[model samples]
Target: MRKSVMTGVGVITAVVFTGGGFAAYNLWNGVTGGTRAAAAQPSTVATPAAKASAIKAPSAEAAAAGAKAFLAAWAKGDFEEAGRLTDRPEAAVAALTAFRTALTPTALTLTPTAERPQAGAPMTFRAEVGLPGAVRVWRYESAVAMVKTGDGGVVVHWDPTVVHPRLGAGKALAIRPVSSSVPSQVVDRKGRPVGAFPSIAAVLDQIEFADDGAQPAGDGTGVVVVGSAGGSGGSEPLFTISASKGAKRQLTLDADLQRVAEAVVKEQSGPASVVAVEPSTGHVLAFANNPAVGQNRAFGGATAPGSTMKVVTAAALLETGLTPDSPVPCPKNTNAGGRLVPNDFTDARLGYTFKDDFAQSCNTAFIEAAQLRLKAGSLPAVAKDVFGLGLVWKTGLSAFDTDIPVETNPEQIALAYVGQGRIRTNALAMASVSATVQSGTFRQPVLVPGKAQPMAARTLSATVLNQLRSMMQRTAQSGTAAKALGSISGAAAKTGTAEVGGQNPNSWITAYRGDLAVAVEVQAGGHGADAAAPAAAKLLQLGNSH
Candidate 1:
């Protein structure tokens, strides 16, 4: 009996030890290889198909509950909660934040409307936000769709406002009141008033903003008053002016030359504008419009400058100790920031001096000069501060803002050196540059003299200016600008043809003859010599005759 009891105890001991060993093995597996065990197991959870069939469609009450929770969270600044309620939690947080930032106490209120569940898809909810303090209440409607997740939670699949509203066509914001009074009289450098027709208010109404409820002044005499209709159905004049108080002076513009420029532009295309500025005093002598009178693009239209910007590049190079005699490699094509820089105008090319390159409008020559020879830093800043390429110059009568790309990348700088990329300037401003070069001092170009402040001071040295003048004269005498105004005595000019697709490209001729400096542009014209130079020559002759 004693022996039997010992045997039984031995067996029990073995069994206990084996059970403990098995438990220890499981604990070790759980710590080191839990992922493997989990992968090996066949999950009893339902598949996406099974879940779709098993889950009930969301009721209207549930959708409303979700929307209310979302809005409440949003109003309370609980972005996380709001996101949790919407399909796009991250986007929901961002949208709610943007709405909060934009909508002040004066802003509108948002209210949710209908809720519907798609048969096999997610549930959708709708809402509207109304603008209150505005003259007109602008309403923005939004919709959101929610879907069930595998984790028994809901996720938004479609936030229509977040996705579609940005893509949808919508009207621009209501027009605001004009800030300042329209200039009535444009006076000359001699203090003589320009010819009076109508105030800018009247002209803008006739041209661009008539339906905005601008009213002409009563009494039908000298000045015109612009008024807006008040809420009480009465016209409240926003501005008042006297027309006959200023002297009626005439511009130096030749009607015949202006018509010829218009004809050239029309022959090329409908979308074109021309500006002629006197380089001596920066007076805008002739401004012409193509596509008739309604399409006014002379001062406002912004197009890529192309190679015309090389003038600034040349100026920069000259300022940085590079003379016209500087030697630069005339590569057929060179890589600039991974882009191939090539000479576009001519096929027959050779080594060129800086002067020859500029007169002939060589792209690669300037690029090489700007990068390797000049070694000038910050071309865009120089263009802005020196050449005033992207400045908003107000001519007292009207104003246009220049658009230049503020990119600092190598590609942008390389392209900008050749007047490609996003460099843009109006004809008036371009004329100012020519005037600056001619006068040996930068003068703010103005339609009405003394109306604008005088230009600060001379930006370039007289020696550099003379060098540029000489090169420009050579350009007129034998280079690309030779055909147009070359034979005209005492004319120093530079012509540029900027490539714009499908059109003839923009042509420019800026020159100075004796005392008058002029700048002219022909949009979509074949070449500066063929199109813009003739107009410039005629205007120069007219100015000289006067």
Candidate 2:
């Protein structure tokens, strides 16, 4: 692998592990020279020491040479060198970084599945890599893709998953989240019990009073908590609630919808989240974090929301003199506050309306409109007063506190229109925005009873509301989200791709149909149309079916 690679042949080898002990390693003669076990090898007869080895296909010879070179580099614990043999060495290097050490397979053997291996055929191999901080070997089935080099040698067509299946830019394969022991219930809007959601489980609490008999003692107010640690599941107490006084909270989650969402999210490979609500009322019908990984990211995450925030910006634009059909400039890029903002793929200057820019997700059009049509400090009002952002929402269980701060920086203001810079929100908040648009009024979201109603923000005028809905509908029918969300009747949607530095931008989709509104996010997912929108479409289909 460190060399410029081989040509003309390929070989498939099964790396039979000797379990990485000092004794076994010396016997195998290290990486390439010897692979047979002394016990497994048959005694060789002196007579007729076999003429020449049979001729190998050029592709097979090249593959075998390539595999051996990679194995040798790996044996020296030179993963960096071995990485170079693969097509995607960058991804390979990233995945290999987790091991923090170059490792050799203690034993190796050639087990050719095909007589003469050809380029691009996968070679199955078993390797017990010497992972750092552990004596016991880790065993797994891994395959490498072989491609023909220009000189006729084969090189691995690498995927990061080859190092470890879950290893990617943002993911580390070796570490994972612990399963929750405590349980909590998520119910639908009408107070029907749903399943136990991980988000609710992460912040759930159970209280138990030591002494149960004494008149439930002082109105159950000052009981000492004992033997408790809380995080996910149903909020049922180990002891009786009348005695222990534990809280049994119900969430606005529909069981059927949650199951459907979970099923759809599982079919996808990356991390994702879905927040669905009953639009007429801000009641969550289903909330699911993809694979239920990490923290409760669905309810508590704060991401830029890509173009989805255009919903908020458009609302602000209508408040100004501009109508949906108002002419707007969406050149390739526009300057605002001395900072340039580019439309990702829009050309509104070729004669397009504000509504056209919106459906097409024109970034510069909104930035120009924001500077020319609206005054400074207007977005904070747009977010807080109209969209019900900035309020400390008490959604029964623990939840994300949404923030959309006003920006004085010209570039910040320009980017905010496209949901970059400082505009951060969770799926719950975005779903609420869609619900407000769907219902023509802002409904304060409540996960449990006793949620305080924040002061009423300025309501959207009837004309503005009609136009907003129409624009969203237009987006679903012919815009970016159309490929994913167009089939459903009476559907309206907005897709977003929030840019995160270095890695891929977060994918976002906020949509509403009839009384149901749903928001979805895919972390490090490339774009709204390619990544987030499909997840949203699946959830919507299942939500409607249920």
Candidate 3:
């Protein structure tokens, strides 16, 4: 009864090629619910399994034959004809449309492992898809679903995913940048480039893993489970179907200082990040990380700043007309807004000057100062308006700008003085804070100059700056940071330990030399004095060598 569908396709196609014959074929398709004319019918989106079983069954051999013919047509770029053969014609057309527009494919070819199901599953095949120039091919696994016809032959069962399993909603069979493009050479203050470090190179052109929107090339096509990690380096995404290297980009990174920072944090077991910027120009002198640069931790991590924030809080107190010599209290803990803010091993020296409290990193002292002396209502403005802490910076590269939310909770306000309670910052931001103090004004750091312009900020008064510098000088001389920074002449630094929901708190240190400002963080590395300060000293020494 359906012998006409199984007769030699060449002869059948010739007979069906006439105008009247074509219209009759379309009508029969509509009447019998065949897929070839689905586009002319109503649109329906079905899942893979639903699509596979939509059409009635024919003969097993006929289905295999139909699969072979479908692959052959699709391989030769007869997308319209091949789409007409599927249960959902619109889906196949949509896939073809994406391939043409987005993939920018020049040529494509499909080949089946078996002409008929001799042993394994039927319709398993490979698709060699070419990019713009047809110079490279992304060999993709593809197949066609075959269903039995009511009479005796088989029709191709079709789903758009037959092109690529990840081609559904929210996913696409696309071409994207695995590694970002780099322009010329990024340089330091003196025009010296940090030599090609694998870590730095990786950062310049980020190598996105396979979890991104890239499909595997040349993975097992037939007999492979859907969504399983494919081939070798399963998590590795194919950069592009073709390769086109871009111009070498330049950066404002210092090679020598970067090496010193990398060497210090390279041996650490867990994640660590360090950044060094020039105080006068706000140029990024050096950047290093233990996990090797894919995650730009130095410029854009939203980690809690911990006690290192005291430097900014101190600025607020100084602006409130409180002198460094003003007397203040140091207690173990202060409970406000039903929350307790405690110092690191807080040893209460009931009466201490503001200078002594900052040097010792007394948490409660600064908390009290934030509310009582500085006027809690004006706390947030100190960092944002005065020092440019929370303002949006126009850094050339991607950066996590500081987020210092205004605090209404007394406990939270106290926590804010100590770098907690909704206050978040990145290494670049903290380094800028130190730089602002050292330079007496804010200068936003930049990777590529002129690309990111800096915003003007309110500067500290000369007297206030002198006193702040004096306080930090005392810190390096005999306070919490003294042990690590004692050897470096003129070194002034502050240390912090931020609680990050774990057994150990994250360690941090922001330091400055004559013209250099550096910030470092060690995730879950305990006390800042023990983990972050030593690394800071080493980097400061290297930058000073210039």
Most lDDT-accurate candidate: 3
Quote model 3's TM-score. 0.63
Candidate 2 residue-wise lDDT, 70-184, digit = tens = 5444444344556577655544443433233112234323222333346545565444443222223333455555666544445666654454333333322221122222223
- The CA lDDT at 266 in model 3 is 87
TM-score of each: 0.56, 0.59, 0.63
Candidate order, TM-score descending: 3, 2, 1
TM-score of decoy 2: 0.59
lDDT of 3 by residue, 1-546 (tens): 001000001101111222211111111111112343342232333423334444455455666667766655454445556666666555664555434444434445555655456422446665555444422345556566677544434557665557665443333333333332332333454666543664565454332212222222222111111222212122224333323332223456777887887887786668888888888888877778878744778877897889999988887788778988899888888875678777787478888999999899988888877777765656578788766877777666678888887767677777778887778887888888888889987888876655544565578889888888888878888889999998889999888989877658898999999999999998888888988999899987766555
Comparing 1 and 2 on lDDT, the stronger one: 2
Instruction: Provide the lDDT at 5 for model 1.
Output: 7
Q: Candidate 2's error at 14, in angstroms? A: 26
Task: State each model's CA lDDT, in order.
Answer: 0.52, 0.61, 0.65
List runs of model 3 lying over 4 Å from the truth. Answer: 1-180, 184-195, 206-248, 544-546
Worst 10 residues of 2 by lDDT: 1-10
